[model samples]
Target: MSQPTDSSAWPPPAPRTPRHARRRKLRRAALTLVAAMAPWLAGSWGASRSSTCTPRTAHADPSFWEQVTQEPEEAARLERYQAEMQRGHQQASLVLGEGRQRDVEPLPPLQRRQLTQEARRAFQRAARIRPTVAEPHYYLAVFTFFALHSCAQCQFDPAIATEIVEELEAFEALSPLDPRLTSLLGDRAILYTRLSGHATPAKTREYLERAIADYRAIIARSAGLRQRWELTYGNLAEALMMIGDLEEAIATYRLAQRHASTASILLGLAVAMDRDERGVEARTLIRELGPDAVASWEEDVLRGDTFYVPQGEVHYYRALIAETRGDINGAIAAYRQFEQSNAHPQFAPRAAANRAALTRAVTRAVR
Candidate 1:
C-alpha cells in the first residue's frame, strides 16, 4: 500500500532511574513522538509501486484525473483514477522528502497542510469516482489514518478514527477474498493497536483483539505470501504483548521464526523473550546478530531506500538488558556505542543521557 512518508520506531524514550519522574517524561515524550512519526499507513511509496507503474504527474498537470474521466471506457477511467492515487501518495513523500532529521528542516506547517490536503482530496476523488473499487477506498483509509498524526499537537479524534475504520470496512466488503485485503487489515491492526496505549482499557483491549484476529486471519490465508505471513505473525505477537499475553507473544514469534528469519523478526523475538523474562535467550539472540549481520541488514534496508530498520534498536535494548542485570560498565559501553553509531537523533540522545547517568552513578558509588 502507498502512503505518506514518516519516521520509524517512534517508541517512548528509554526510562531512566528514579522511576516515577522518568515515567512521566516517557508519557509526554511518547505523545510528542507519536505525532513526530506521522503514523503513515505504509512503507515507502516508491517501493509500493511495481516496475510497470507510471506516475500521473509525469506530465505535471493537476487536471489529469478530470481529463481521465472523459475517457469512454470505465476500465480506462479506473486506471487513470488509480494512477492519480499513486501520484497523490508519491507527492506526499516528495513533499516531506526523506524524513525530518536533527540537521534537516521539515516542510513548513502551512505548505505541509496544503499539500496534505491535496493528497487527501486526490484520494477522496478517486473513491468518489470509482465507488466500487477497493483500491481507492484503501488509499482513502491510508490518507485518513496518516492525517490523524500529520501535524504536531494532534490528538486522537474519535470521529476521524471511526472514519478510518469505516473506510477499511468498506474496502474489505468490496474485496472480501482479495489477498491485498490482508495488507489493509494489517494496517488497521497496526494503527489501532499503536494508539491503544493512550486510549481507555476497554478501547485498548478492543483494538488489540481486532489486531490479533486480523494477524491470525492473514496466517490462515497464507497462499503465496510467506513474507507477509512472517510480518503479520510478528505483529500478532506484538499485539499480544501489548495486552500482557506474553506467553502467546513468545510462541507467535517462534512460529514466525520457523517460517522466515529476518532481522526484523529476530528483533521481535528478542524483545518478546526479554519481556517474557527469558533474558538468556534474548542475550543469545542479540549476540547472534553480531556486527556483520547488523551491518548487512542496514545496508539492505538502505539499498531499498527505506529508513526504518528494526535492527537499529538491538544495541539499545542490549544495553538495557545489561543494566538490568547490574552490569553498569557493560551497559555504559553499549549505550555509548549505540549513540555513536545510530542515525536516529531521538534514540541517540536517550542513549547518551542513559550513558551519562550511569557513569555518574557509578562514580558517586565509588566515592
Candidate 2:
C-alpha cells in the first residue's frame, strides 16, 4: 500500500487537462516506454543473479539402508530439477543475451514467444518436482515479467504484473536473507515505477508508494555492504519526488551525492529544489553543472551506469529551468530536444503540453 502523495497538489504550469484525457495519453505513452526499456531490463535480470539451488547436505546419522535407498532417490530428484532449471535458463539466456553485451538483436516476436513459453514450461516442471525450493519461482518471476508479459507488442496487464509480484513474494518467503533479494526488490520497484505510467491516478499513486517502500527496504537490507548503494538512494529519491515529497526527495538526493556525485543525482536534487520553491538554489546547481558537462555525462557516464536518469530527463529539466527563468524560446528548444530523445513515458506528455503552451504564448506575443 502507498502513502498519500497527491501529485495534483503540485502547481501545474497550465490549466489541468481533463483527467480521462490525460490518463488515455499516459496509457499510450506507457506502452511505448515499457517496450523501449523491457529488453535491457530483461537482459539485466539474466545477468544479475545465479540460481539458488543447493544440494541437500548429508544426513548426520543415517542408517545404511537409508543411505542406500532414500538418499539416492532424493539426490536423483535434485539432479533432475537442476538439469531442468539449467535448460530453462539456457533458453532464457538465448533470448535475453549475455551479461552487459545486450546489444544482441532480439529474436523475432513469434520465435521469442515460442522459446519463452518452452522456458516457462521447463521452470514449471522444475517447480513441480521441487515445490519447496525457491529457485524455480525466482526464474518464473523473471520470465513472467521480462519475457512472457513484457513484450514490445503486449499491452500492460495489471493482473499479470500482480502475479509476477506474487511470484517474487513467494521467493522471498522461501529465501528471506538471500544475497540476491536486494536486486530483486530493486527490480520489483522498477516494475512498479513503470506500471504507474499506465495506471489510473489512484493506482499510479499506489504503485509509486509501493516503489518507494521497496527502495527503502533495499537500502535497509544493503546496510554495511562493501559497495555503496548510491543508485538505490537516487531511485528512492526519484520515487519520493514523484509522490510530491519534495523535502524528503531533496534530502535523499543529497545523501546519494555523498556516496557518488553523479550527474543524475545532481539533476534530481536540483529538480526537487525547484519544485520545493528553492529556484535560486536550483538555478545555481544547474549553472554549476554547465551544458557542456551535462552533454559529456550523457555521452560518457550515463551509458556505463546502471542507475542513471533516463536518457531525455536532462533535457526535460533544462526545459523546466529555462521556463522558470522566462526564457520561453530556450524552454521550447529544450522541450523539442527532449521529445526527440528517448524520454521517459510519464514526462513525455508533460513536455509536449508545456511546449505547446509556450508556443501559443510566443505566437500571442508576436500578434
Candidate 3:
C-alpha cells in the first residue's frame, strides 16, 4: 500500500506546533537531567535522503487514488489505529505532565513504572497495527528516550541506546520527507556521541564517526537555514576534533563562523587551530573574543547553562594560550584546573602530558 502523504495522517506536526506541545515539556525535562549529566548534550541538526516520489510524480501514482476508495472496514481500522496511537501519546504526555504549569509531583516508583509501561504498550500496539506508518515509531522513540533520561536510577545503557536508534531509523525510513526527520537525526547523533563518552577507545571512535556523519548530513539538509547550518557545523567540528581530525575540524569551524561567529564556535575554532599548529591565528581569534568573553563562556558551561560546548574544554584551550604566551605557572594552573574538572576522558591525558612537559622545562631552566 502506498504511504499516506497527508501530514495529518502520518508523521504529525513539528514539536513547536500546538498539537505537539507535550514535546516541549518533554524537552525541558530531558534537558534538565542532561544538564546534570553532560553540558554538551543539547542542540539539534540533521539530514536524510530524498523520497523517490518527486512532487511531479506524486500526482501520477495509481495508489494515490486507491487511498480515497478505501472500504469502510479498512477506514475503520485506520481510525482505530490512529486512536490507539493518540491514546498512547496522550497518556505518555500526561504522565510527564505535558502542559501543567507546576512541575509533576514525583510519582512513587511502582506507579511511575506502571504508567510508563502502559504508555509504551499502547504505542507498541499501534506500531503493530500500522507498521508502515511513522508516527507510532516516532513517539515510541521519543517516549523511550525521555523516560529513561528522566528515571533517576536508570544508567546509560548501550542496549537501550541501540533500541532507541533502531526506532529512530525506522521513523526516518518511513518518513524521509517529513520536516522532523532532521531533528530526529540530530537527536540520534547526540545519543551516539553521549554513548561514546562511556565506551572503549575503539567504540568511542566509531560512535564519534557516526555523530560526525549525522552532523554533516544535517549541515547539508539545512542549506539556506543559516542558524541550523551554523549549529550543526559547530557540532560536526567538535566531533571531528574528538576523532583527531584536526584539519577538517578547523575547516568545519571556519564554515560555521561564516554563518554566525558565536562564542562557542570561536572557542572551538581557536582550539582546533592551536592544535593544528596555527597558533598565531588561534591566538588572534582568542584576542577577538577577549578574556572576558572566554571567562563568561566558561562560566556558563560550568554552570550547565550552555549547549554545544563540553565542560572544561575551555580550560584546556586556556592552558594552551597561556603556554604560548610563556606563562609557565599560569599554563600549569589551567591544565590542573582542566584535570580537576574531569571532563573529556580522551583529552585528560594530553592535558596531563602538557602540564608535565611544562614542569620539566621549568626545572631545567632553573638549573
How well is each residue in 1-367 modelled by candidate 2, as lDDT tens digits?
1111111111111122243443444465556556655666665566566465333333333454344445445655766777788778777766655222547665787887787788778888988898898888788787777664544455557677776787888888898887667766876887687667666778878988988989889778878876446777888898888777888999999998899877677878887776676767886887777666667655654443333233355677778668766799999999999888744445566668778989999999999
Q: TM-score per candidate, in order?
A: 0.47, 0.57, 0.65
Candidate 2 residue runs with Cα over 4 Å from true position: 1-90, 93-113, 128-132, 143-164, 297-316, 323-326, 332-367
**Going through the candidates in order, what is the number of backbone clashes in each?**
0, 0, 1
In candidate 2, which residue pairs get closer than 3 Å at backbone N, Cα or C atoms, i.e. clash? none
Q: What TM-score does prediction 1 earn?
A: 0.47
Query: Where in model 1 is the C-alpha error above 4 Å?
Result: 1-139, 142-163, 173-180, 292-367
lDDT (0 to 1) per candidate: 0.62, 0.69, 0.69
What does the lDDT read for residue 125 in candidate 3?
90
1 or 2, which is superior by lDDT?
2
- Candidate 3 per-residue lDDT over residues 1-367, each given as its tens digit: 0001111122343233244344444565455545543422221111123354332211224553353334444545666676677778766765565324367576677877787888778888988988888887888887777776424356667777877887888888898887777766676787787677667778878888888878777767876763456667777888899788888999888898888887778888887776666767877887788667777776766544344323466677778768766789999999999888765655677678778989999999999
